[model samples]
Target: MVRLQNPVLKKELKLRFRSFKSFSAIIFYLLTLLVFTVGFFLVVTDFKGKGFIGPEMNVVLFTMLTFVQLSLVLFMTPGLTAGAISTEREKQTLNILLTTSQTSWQIIFGKLTSSISYLLLLLLAGMPISSVVFLFGGISPSDFVLTYAYMIVILIALASIGILMSTLIRKTIVAMITTYGIMLFLTVMTAFFVFVTLSVQTGFDGSELGGQKPFSYFFMAINPLIHMASVIYPEVSESALTVTSMDLPLWVTHISFYVIITVLCLWIATKNIRVNMK
Candidate 1:
């Protein structure tokens, strides 16, 4: 498709690689991940007075790495895209870009891909550290595949949110703030709400529900952390794999939720750009 051949995408990639900031960001991200990874390894081996890690400890490390990456992606995607359009407007370049042969969708797609490309770099850079979990014996290639697939979807959703914010807000700083605020609500507040409601539903009775996880977890289907937890530690988050009441798999639900929300965000962003163009 002509849209797929976006000059903006090409130009963004060129500029991204030409700058040292991209390299610095990757180095910093990898260092942070490695530091935590080593901490996990030490905690597992030293706390247990064992010189070597077991398979279970390896799974623990894998889960820790998954969540660590999740945290990074959740916080980083917004900043990567929150200024995609707003920065252009701030520099008085958005109008010029809009007037180009590039369609609104193409422009949005280009910016979105460029932002995610950098995120992919960070993901790749952390692979060696994550791979260490395999040395102790517990992760499967399928698990890594599933986890990365989930991560890509989450990043797309978050980046779309940021671009939508950039499209709606005029100032880059304001857009960034607004995007982070929304991301915080979705990622943190949703989990808190689900936990509170489930705890109340259980009413501290350990045996009332026959030990089944409450359907309240369905409320967190849109949450990336919950999805990652399910993929990385399925035994611990089996409730996230299905809604017994609905007869539907959670992965299906998760992907559907993300896709619908991403489409809505991008559609609204395109409309905002169209209006601005007129």
Candidate 2:
């Protein structure tokens, strides 16, 4: 059984809260979410028109909030975790950690959980406002769960990427940038690549209009955003062939890719930390 008594996690959690920058970041994040949600609400209710929101708008509102929150998660989680190990190395404290009773894997997992704990705070704090969609009554509990569950999976995958980069790179800033660059490749470049490829094959206007090739499905499978869109609209598979020729849903492939990434990245990180031990 995995142990929950990680001293490193406890220590980092304490220090994170004690830091002024951490508090300020939390405050700023919450304020931005609050204001954005309020403005959305005002616009939805039609400040000059309907003065009230209807149930029909629930899906639209939830879609907007979900995508916005997902974007924030993608942006913030990498920053928080990309410095996890590299920051310690910068302070010459990683040697201290290496000498501790904790295994390198323990250290890796501990730092990861501590960093994700802060991200959890941001996600949970935003929930009440996002829940306004639930009150209006179009989004089912199952839909909500699927969307967020995939999000958590994506965060774990991204966090693992950050941890691996943090382990490999000596400079925290460089590691952070590299981690985000990888994220950009996964999220944006992959999508663009598929689009350009499709355009070339089918023509820009799709005048020839050949069916989607299997190669396109591969890109869509790797992209978190595309899968998240599938989750939002079940009908998407009907349109995009679930971004794959396979019978399984696109999310199944999306999650499978992320799971492999998380495990592979963590394994590489643990191995690196062990190899560098002096």
Give the Cα lDDT of each candidate.
Answer: 0.81, 0.84
C-alpha lDDT (0 to 100) for residue 122 of candidate 2:
79
Candidate 1 structure quality by residue, lDDT tens digits, 1-278: 76358899999989987799888988889988988987876786676655877888788778888888889998999888999999999999988998899998889989999999999888878888888866767789899878878998888988999999999999999999998998888788778877765666554555334343434556567667776777776653555433223345567778998899899999999888766433
Tell me the tens digit of each residue's lDDT in model 2 across 51-131. 666667778888888888889899998899999999999999998989888988889998999888888887888788777
Best by TM-score: 2
Best by lDDT: 2
Backbone clashes in candidate 2 total 0
How far residue 20's Cα lies from its native spot in candidate 2, in Å, is 3.1
Cα misplacement distance, residue 69 of candidate 1 (Å)? 0.9
lDDT of candidate 1 at residue 94, scale 0 to 100: 89
